[model samples]
Target: MPPATLSRTEQSYLLDGLRSKPAERADRRDLHEYRMMQVDTDLSLQADGSARVVLGSTEVHCGVKAEIESYDAPHVNVSTDLEFAPWLPPSPRVQVMVEYSPALLHEHNATELAMITDTVQDMLQACYALTGNSIGPLDARQFIVVPYARYWVLHLDVYVMSWSGGNVLDAVFAAAFCAMYQARIPGTKILALDKAAARQDDEVDQDDPAGIKFITRGRKPSSSAALDDAVDFALENEWDHGRLLAGREDVPVCISIYPFEDTYLLDPTLEEETALSSSIAVLASARGHIYGIRQRGSGELTLDAIHKAADVGASYAKQLAQTLQARFV
Candidate 1:
């Protein structure tokens, strides 16, 4: 039910109970306690990496795809919002997309959906984006094959299968972190680039109107003498030979906090989230480094409240990271 649907009596009861000494929650959980979560990885044989995270009723899946791309693609500078890690390199482009299921869409309107997408994308990009200032510790040795010719580009697709309750951001980020950690970049075989051969392969399209000409890439038959030295790059078929993604343990884990009158809530249910006036999502590493902090509520927050939220997020991040890392070990 929406916040408006909460009866006045119920709201009063909630507020009184929360404000009482040793605040109480709807489920009798401590302020730092979290809902039970289930995580799985290596879910897709085709994807470089894949994982699923289930928290309360929310289920999110993250898949990692890496493709070899040329330098012809346009480059983008670091985004203003991505002031987290400041990762450099235009190649090995990383793209993140978050999509929701029809069932979830029915519960939320376009605005809510947009907000979810935008928030999740920003958090994921801060750590995983290659073009921006990334809080993620993506190592160049993981995907870079050639310096200027070609590189591995990543496509991280996060699909929300369901949203029942609890912190969706935590679920999304956890799934993505595991998937990226499990990612393996394929090995590439490269020969010297043949500039002369490429020049000779340019073909003229004769169908142009008014004597206009369009140049297109042409290929020679395998048996033709022109293609004997044309093979410049190829991928190795053996999966075992591929390199594992670097900084596998460095992805930031996020903890979302909902502040009540004089207390805070961790892993709040949908109703609890709606009732609260403010929310803070802290993206931090298990190694005791703070990546970024996002505040989404309009409630007036004191300095002490912010610090408490950060401390909670940072402390829980280590525990969450341990939980995720255990899966690989």
Candidate 2:
């Protein structure tokens, strides 16, 4: 990119503006308030939860929705709108729907999008486990024996409304935290899974002096055959009728950084983003379990820098988790 022409006074003013903005602090250091700029919330209607987050002009919108599906792939568990369109290919026995829409993927550069999706999935799965059984209110054994294939699905959609270039992944993570915090899952009671289908009428009524029922279920798809069967089942029924469900809890927090020069920028401006040589994002659970780390793109980040980034990510993650948790109160 060619440099823009400016008079000496204009150049001085620009330099002064840049100087007034604090230099990037070391990863382990606390993030200064001035450097962070601003934080905003509330954006989305249809989702169970939603938030529009802004960090120094960089913008990302996040929404959380829940549904029932029989199966899901492990790594791509975030289940954002980005992957909804691709049509799955038809094998000799099955068809895989796959579609390509640049509009969805265009928001973030290609590599960044991949990182964000994976990070969110890991976090949400952790929360899902606390909700109880993987398949539904019933255990896998019950579901397999009876097999009412309806699965509850949670879709967390992230939209990049604006990008000034800084670390979009970090911003994406923050927005996701806010959205998930605002989300809630309805109380659902498990019915008989062995019957192939369960009805709302079969729900154990707590008020009727009858009784209460609840059960447990995330298995990621490993093979095309497995995915096919799951998809076939998901498309075939609707099973969340009478299940005791819990509100959302334990959201995973992510911190992302793009490394440039010897200095590491927390969120790079568009110009810095273009200048970056490499990027790494670290996702941590509230317990400090390092669930995922994605290191890719063209940059050369040193081993030391990588560790430092994790520390930075972990700190910010804790702060994010605390802030979001407060929202629930």
Question: For each candidate, what is the lDDT?
Answer: 0.69, 0.46
Q: Estimate each model's TM-score.
A: 0.77, 0.54
TM-score of 1: 0.77
Give me the candidate number with maximum TM-score.
1
Candidate 2 regions exceeding 4 Å error are 1-42, 70-148, 190-249, 258-263
Query: How do the residues 1-329 of candidate 1 rate in per-residue lDDT, one tens digit apiece?
Result: 12334677877787676677787878897766888889988889888899999988889999998887655322232333211111224533678888888776666776777777787887777665543223257654445444234567789999988766657888898998898877887666555434433344332122321111211222232222123344456676666457776677777888898877666788877666666788889998767567889888678888899999899889888888878888887
* 1-329 per-residue lDDT for model 2 (tens digits): 01123466755554343344454332322222224534455555566667877776666777766654443322233353111211111111001111112454545455655554555444434333322232211122212211233334456566666555355566666776676556554544443432211222233343421111212112222332132322122222222232322323334566666654444555544444444446677776555656567785676677898888787767766666676667657
